[model samples]
Target: MATIFTPGPALQSNSSEQNRFMEKLMAKILSFYDEQSLIDVTFKVSNPTAVVPAHRLILAAASPYFENLFRGEQGNNPVIEINDIDSDTLERLITFCYTGEAPITVNNVGAMLKAAIVLQLNDAINSCVDCIMKNINGYTLQAAYTLERETQCERLKQKLIEYEIKNFMEISRGVEFLSFDVEKLQRILESDNLNIPREEDAYDAIKRWFNYDVPARQEPLPHLIACLRLTQFDADFLLTHIQPLPGCELLAFKAISWIREPAARTKISMRFTEPRATCEETFLVICRSEMNYKLLQYNKAEDKWQEYASLEIDYTNYWPILKDENILFIGGYKNGVSCNIVRSLNIRNKTWQNLPAMNQARRGHRVVELDGKIYAIGGLEGNKVLSSVERYTPSDGWEFVSSLTVGRFDASAEILNGKLYVLGGRNINGALKLVECYNPDSNTWTSCADMTECRVSLHVRVHKGHIYVLEKYSANQSSQSVERYDPERNTWSKICCLNAEWARIENVFSFDNKLWSFGHPKHDDISSVSVYDEDNDRWVKKCSLPNVDRYTYNIVPVALLSSK
Candidate 1:
């Protein structure tokens, strides 16, 4: 009958529809392989002999190797010998050809990778490589390295190398590390990203690797030693450990010569003197908002302030000392009185721990860590400004070390040349230009050169063998000045004057290897952070702190945080 045939609604060629069709088609194809239907090729793999049947059409479509192999001759159920790939890997590869996915895990990734390489299956190769990288650990690292080298995969090689460097301390002790060839080890040692505590540790690692099979690795000692940052080693380390080595005497002496001659230090290789990526530096700002105490971390690179921690404390003006991974908030004023409550916040775990209180209830004091001990300098206790100083050690807790020459609060202090230098602060008689230096070795105070101005609530920072003091704004002062103190010369010099816009500066500190001052402009609510340009001798405005105003922010540099 000539009946009109009405076409049903045509399906949409959208991405979702295409994806569903492909998914169903893949399921049907995999089912065909599962049922061994339409199979025209047999792969025979040897190590533990087995056979896998796959469709020649599907195999050729997925792999260039199979496509090129079957282009000329048409054969039914052609048998192919695979001596390199085992039976299980061949099955996995065939399954991936049907379904576009395989069970690529760490254990079988190397085998599958080799099989994919042999068959020239690019998708399977990528899947195998991703699995190896994602699951790489101390156990599988060396094998992954070898697989990368065999395949010449640059991405896999770089990932493995970075992992090795970051985890060098632990991996250096493993037997797998010993399997690294001299070239590989040399490349790792030459990297500045080796997360080692010191250059000596790299040398020690090389020594251990060499001593494992000395006869085999001894000839490469000089080559490996050259990769070390020899200038970082001291004379004692060089003469004691390096000179005794069989072939490292020349390297040791040359490093020692560089260390002895300051001018000749420039001639030392830059790679050898570049610092390792052992620790990170960050600015931790503590401020009081309307409701709670907020801790902010200034991301200098991004020019952004990230809220790090929030504490429900009824105190303001607490000092944060970066001890390992913890920030020790020492003493603060609570309810119109100074309290000696010490609290530590572990930045890694975001846990708060209460530490032993200081000997005196002191606020407006500065704390410095020197030689593994914490020294709490002068601060006021109630109405009386105290001249007492307390030192804290793990063994002794808090004890009186030495008293300051003058009792004052809101003063600035820093450690220089193993001595504590306390700068100008206001006493009961108003501000004083007095500076005192306390030597821990002698347990006595010595007078240092005084600042040019009487500074109260000033910020003191030590940089490059000098102490920098930036004064707070006052109604009487016309301009805020930054003074530099030479510890060796025992003299004070004015480095530069702060911009009039920064007259109401709140805090000045060292962060990211530069002297920075942060405050708001006069009659402004937004706080500005500026980095001191040493060469230009000017404060270049960088960015503004978030959620913090001019009057309430307390900022400090927290460089290293312990994983523990």
Candidate 2:
């Protein structure tokens, strides 16, 4: 037995009672909906087998679509044709007009929304948009995007972006993602809101779309590739995945130059370095030793360093350079010998390849990239210091550049303000505070203001247009202090002193505007790492390296890549 909460049925007062009375009234009115005794309008749906009969008053009172039709009618009975929407969708929409509610699923949300839009039923269209949002997923996201795109549904489009951004990586891995229209894909890529942790994922998505059917999709590659941050993708990724493609020739060359010159990033319209561009920023650490080199990637989510590979050569005293997913070991010592074997390791493929060796066998030298060319300067050769500078151009091999005034070894070098500046290193003078600036065009080294302190064992980097040097305090390196040089004034000032613990910091990288140092320092023996809170001017211990081995590891040469 069903409870009749409507009491006497004389127009209920409570909300629930009103709903019940309305439903019952709708059912009763719908019972006589097609009866000829009251029938005045007939609708012929586009589906051949469908025809619906309705009373003029019931429809005219509920919908302007039928109201306008009835007002313009000239005969006793008029047959109206609704060819825009098929019968099933129209039938449900007609019921919704009377009942003030409609039931819909993901499969029919598009059709129902379409009919409601054509009928000028704003309420029903809102209901359809809500329904679409509730059911949107990887399977239906693209369809909803396409449908709403055509319908111009702004509310639904916003819901689509929120739902789809989190699943971008998953969507790219799907076959449907590869099948999206080039324009549609580009629209999605244009968003700064995309949650692609790695710029590589964005690049990979485009590669998949182009290669899905190369012969047919080749034409759109140019337009689509324009959306990626190609310059940010380093050299190996562009070479392996994009550079080899004949269609990517010009784009690849421009991207390579872009990597070398980040300031002139006008060629590409987008960059992946923004705060919201990714979920987690990924970085790498190059663990170098006299015997071998190990590549480790630190995963923030996992809070651990996973080794990428162990190379076959002794990269000790090596000058490393990164081009995308690979690192170049340019003229480093192998087995205590100054070897000029220039090799590169593809971090993605874990494969090594050799490039043309330098004109002179060099180790403990400074290598820096400027204007798309490599310059190696100042290093020791079997206890003897050499200043023979050489320039390397891709495909052009190495050419002799003007040598440094004083022979330097173990010198730290970084390019800044369009000039290569080599900082503190051991010259014949020993642990000198010498600072010199090298001009590529002029091929000359100009002496600059020396540092406040000297360093034989030092960690040097250029950050925010300033050169920072960490100098050791003692033989055990238990105490240390840092000084930064302002290029504008060519002056060095002491910043802060670090607990001798940082003496072992082989490599350092800054993320989220915080400094991260990698390596175990001194008697701490346990591999220790720390993060420098710039605001406090102090180092906060972050974590310790895995204690899998008794051998203390030396980590250096850090690079920032996409987390994915």
Best by TM-score: 1
Estimated TM-score per prediction? 0.55, 0.51
Q: Which lDDT value does model 1 have at 55?
A: 88
Q: Evaluate residue 555 in candidate 1 and report its C-alpha lDDT on the 0 to 100 scale.
A: 36
Candidate 1 lDDT, tens digit per residue, 1-564?
678855345544466776788789888887888898887788888878999998888888888888887785544447877788888888888888887889988778878888788898888877777788777763377777678878876656666778888778678878888878887898898887787644556876898899899888778888888888776655656776777787989888888888677688767653465445553356667776564677677776787887777777777656667664567888878899988988888766778889889889888887888655788888878888989999887678889877888898888888776678888888899998999998888899999888888888887776546788877774445566778988779999997566556656777765454677777666666777788797787778776776443234433323233333
Question: What lDDT tens digits, residue by residue, belong to model 2 across residues 51-108?
Answer: 8776778777777876777777542556777788999998888878767788788778
Instruction: Specify the poorest-scoring 10-residue window by lDDT in model 1.
Output: 555-564
Ten consecutive residues with minimal summed lDDT in candidate 2?
A: 550-559
CA RMSD of each candidate after superposition: 10.8, 14.0
- Say which candidate scores most in lDDT: 1
Alpha-carbon local distance difference test for all models:
0.76, 0.71
- How many Å off is the CA of 24 in candidate 2? 51
State candidate 2's TM-score.
Answer: 0.51
Segments in model 2 whose C-alpha atoms lie over 4 Å from true places: 1-281, 288-293, 472-478, 534-538, 546-564
